[model samples]
Target: MSDQDSSSSSSSQTEEELDGEMDEETNGEVEKEESHRDSPAQSLSTFSSSLRAVIRIKQKYQVMKQRRQEMALALSGAGTFPGAPTRTSPKIFTFDGVTPSAFPMLSSSNPQKKKRRRRKRVLFPNRGTCRSPPKQERSRAKYCLYLLFAIVFVQVYNAIENLDDHVLRYDLEGLEKTLRREVFGQQGAVEGLLVHLKDYLSTYVHNKPLVVSLHGPSGVGKSHLGRLLAGHFRSVVGETLVLQYYVLHHCPQEADALQCAGDLSAIISEMVERAEEEEKIPLFIFDEAEHMQDEILDALWTLVASKQSNEYLNAIYLFLSNMGHAHITKHMLHNSSSTSMASGRHSALVKELTPVLRSSLEKLHQLWSEANILPLGLLEKGHVMECFLDEMTREGFYPDHSNIERLAGEIEYYPAVGGHEYSQTGCKQVVAKVNLL
Candidate 1:
């Protein structure tokens, strides 16, 4: 009975020892799981710190990039001309929000020369490696960049255009010297036109825009004079500002006539606005003004009456037509004095006869109907026979009469005494007729 008791006690003791070992094994397993769980948290913390560092770097990079762009704009403006790039003083970077502990500070122990060389190599004073911006920050930064680029481009273009304008301003010294040499026997008329034109273009003449109506028989230098004026003005003002539209060519079909008129209105509006901005005079020439549709004329009447935008104040309008030619000739025929007829100086006669022609143009309501005229008059007379003959010869037309007498005789002016037809057609058929003659 005592040995049975001892065996039972020994078994109980062994059972307790086994349970303690099992408990230790379970505790070890729990500790291992806790350590594994803690590792994820530590790794997350590390990742967060790395993200903050990258954000800081990006911020610094953005600041540096903006500063560099500003510097580049300034440098480009200064170096707009070729052959030399502008040199500006180097700018130093400011470390405002950055912490020295976060990023190691780089120190330069090199000489001034070495430092200058390094500075030249660097795009920015504070260049550093950094990751791309975050998505939200990236979008904001792109918008700012685009805005900055647009503003810079506009400013640069304005500056360049201002410089270009200064270069483009020309001197019309010799051009102003010999103005009326193109046409013959119309020196008086041409001189009169030029005087008024120059006066109208005069800077002090701020009264209103000039409106010149050129009237004559067909083949007169009316259209040719218009071309000459275009060339002269193109030399003075740019070719862009001198707009010549022919009613016969542009306003052909009756269907789209109104549309063409509206298009012209829009164009005139834009050109007037442009002229006002540039402080320059714009010229609009309507060749064959008598032939345009009434609707188109109404569109132009706005410019004529100065009834459109205030910007129209800086523009000039020229109307070339044969509307008042018959009235001019009748007045001349009735009033040609015996002294004038005997002197036979055509220039003097045309010059003296201008007053009656002006009166006749006033009666013709078709021209400058309600508009205020500024030194306005009709520029008339065909090319002089002498000038016509020279031009014909220059054009490789050798008439049978080498003396230029036959060509001169053929160039007949309007209101020829009884039954002669000479230059009444102006410069129109002289060449073709030269072959026929």
Candidate 2:
């Protein structure tokens, strides 16, 4: 029984130890539950802090990604530069917040390419554009056109100057002064002749030769005027260009008409050919044309009407005739009395007598119709006295007015109105009378 009781005591001790250990375990579990219930605010605060930190990190990541995308866009086209290394995708970037320019290897090549491209743009601005052709060539062509126009203008100016020179070489002004000074008592005849000369000689080109016909009575200065022209032309153009042919002297009344016509044509042709070779205009005087036969006139008409050659075109022909002397004298003595009335009478005579004379001359031959008719009017006693004075002076004798008046009075006069006597034989005997003096 003592051994049993000792065992029970030990058992009880063990049971108490066991109860203490259980009690300790239950208290630790209670403490742990109380601590957990009391720290709820701290745990909630830590969870909120962690969530805010995560949100901040996510926003920073998003911002960095956006900036990287923008940087990539900005640097995207860099690889497209000519002579640079090409990339499959231009948007090359790293998400480490490091730009492409940050690396020396990439930036060094990029600046050189950029400088090269800028240099290319500055140097070859229009290298591959629409205006790439040669501008200098077009400018040169424009300059050539300007030069061509200038050349043409200069040529035309020279042509005009040459024409002026041609007209000025004729010395027509000298001829006009000489006619006004020397010719007398026939103011209208002188003026008409001067006008025709000026008109014809102003230009060297003409379709036909000029033909002038002088008609009047005997001793009315027709032959005198012809002699004056022959002398004047001989002095002016040198004697080689003047041909004076008198019907009584060249082809006399007794000569064969056909032979005379042939000889006259040959002589005229030779003279014209010689004058043309010398580049000179010739003067042909055919005096006493009324005495010319039909065959001689026909030959002259053929020669004068020739337009076959330029040599035949440049000439002057004077035909002195007495065909209309009766009409010319009647018109002059009836109309004109003094020198003052001479000019008025001359215009009327030309108006009235030109048609009458032309018709009369056309009846003889059509060649005379084309002739420019100049009528010589009758001279008054005063004109006859002046003629006497001129002849006396030319013969180296003293020209006393009384002696000239006596010599003029000796000549017969036509019985006219107002007792204004007109000389019947005007200056025809003045030279012979002066010789006697």
lDDT (0-100) at residue 42 of candidate 1? 62
* Residue pairs of candidate 1 with colliding backbone atoms: 218-425, 219-425, 219-426, 219-427, 220-426, 412-422, 412-423
Q: What RMSD does each model have against the real structure?
A: 27.9, 25.9
TM-score between model 1 and native: 0.51
Per-model lDDT? 0.61, 0.74
User: How displaced is residue 250 in candidate 2, in Å?
Assistant: 1.3
Worst 10 residues of 2 by lDDT: 85-94
The sequence of per-residue lDDT tens digits that candidate 1 reaches over residues 1-437 is: 34434444544454466556555654655565556556756676565655665565566556655655565455445443566544433435677535645554333333556778787678444335445554643467888999999999999999767645543453333344544456644555565666665555544225556777666666666777778778877877787788899987887887888999999998888887777777777888888877878778777776676544556766788888876677655645554444654454545656655555666556645546543222212222323455556566667766344545555555545464433323555556555755664
Clashes, model 1: 7
Candidate 2 local lDDT, 1-437, one digit each (tens)? 44434444544454466557556655655565556557756677555655665565566556655654564444435425567553333234656668776688877897899889998889757566756576654456888999999999999999878666654665666666766665557777877887787677656678998899988877878888888888877876668788899887877765588898898877778877887787777889999988888989888888777564877788899999889888877766666555545345565556567887888788889789668998877777877877877787788989888887788889998986455677788778987887786
